[model samples]
Target: MGLPGTIPPAQGPARPALAVVDVQPHLQQPATDRGPGRLHLSAEGASRAAGGSGGGEAVKVILLRDVPTLGRAGTLVEVKEGYARNYLLPRGLAREATAGAIRARDVMRQAEEQRRARVQREAEQLAQGLSALILEMRARAGAEGRLFGAVTAQQVADALRQRGFPVDKKQVELEHPIRVEGFHRVAVRLPTGRLVQVTVNVVGQR
Candidate 1:
């Protein structure tokens, strides 16, 4: 009835290796959406939205505190309407959608602005003090003005200490170790949002 090795007809449906389906309407969630979020009130009166709380007919704003990465003052973030009502607003982390909350938010913003200005003023004062910083070096150099190797942070720190101004090596911010002989301005980090600039004058050895 058949030639050698001829196969018979198949009967049942083929098995599925894998199944892929569209996401159900309930499960179709967005990773990030812009909507209402929780508005956190600051002691200084600035309002920012804390993480997670947000929503409603009125736009929600979540107020966050002075997180290091997020800067000095609190910040507001908008989130979705539904999420704000069901989760964020009820948790006391954020206030309701109203005119009173908005007015309070403006006050909070003004307070934060004043604080920033004060910090900036202090930073300028620190910079001015650093003008007197002069670093001397003891290196073996030739007529062309190139050093034997390169000047490093350890060298700079040691020299600063001998001059009576004890500076920490870690506070120095250099793009690269000083190799060429020239005058350069190096930044020194200080406390309370302050920064100091030190002058480096590399001269040839006699």
Candidate 2:
């Protein structure tokens, strides 16, 4: 029926639909090109916590020497629950690389480099002074002219102090005691590959 002015009634309810296209570049990249293999994780997800059956966390290891658990510096290695908890984490050798941790690492690395440089310079100065002096040791000897005890690192340090060198006992590396000695080459580890050859003259005591 026609009226003067009128509106029509609603026909049906409206429903919403969602359309999705996978466009994550990180996800599109291959696993091998992404992380330290074995498990496939995107670079973005690698740093964060995992979502697998066994929840594993990422760790950053700084290797001073050749440590077993901590592979090397700048290496992101995954470790099991016990190994990281029992050993690595407690030793101040490694830490979980959260966003904050990564930033802190950069700062620490810079500070460490500066400290290393200062130590190297100090070692160089010590090396230069060590080269100019000769070490003398007086000890009781047998009839064959062999020393009763030996000229050891302590003896070397003592003599060095007497001669005004004042080197630490630890800096001297003696494989064996200087029993039969004339002039021996002692390796003093100095900075920047600088080495000093100090001559030790052992005289027989009365």
**For every model shown, what is its TM-score relative to the native structure?**
0.40, 0.45
> Residue by residue across 74-121, what tens digits does model 2's lDDT show?
445565444345444574545665677667767878898999999888
TM-score of model number 1: 0.40
- Cα-based lDDT at residue 109, candidate 2: 84
Residue-level lDDT tens digits of model 1 in 2-42:
67899867779998789888432121232365233323333
Error of 1 at 198 (Å): 4.0
lDDT of each: 0.59, 0.60
**Runs off by more than 4 Å, candidate 2:** 1-106, 142-144, 161-170, 190-195
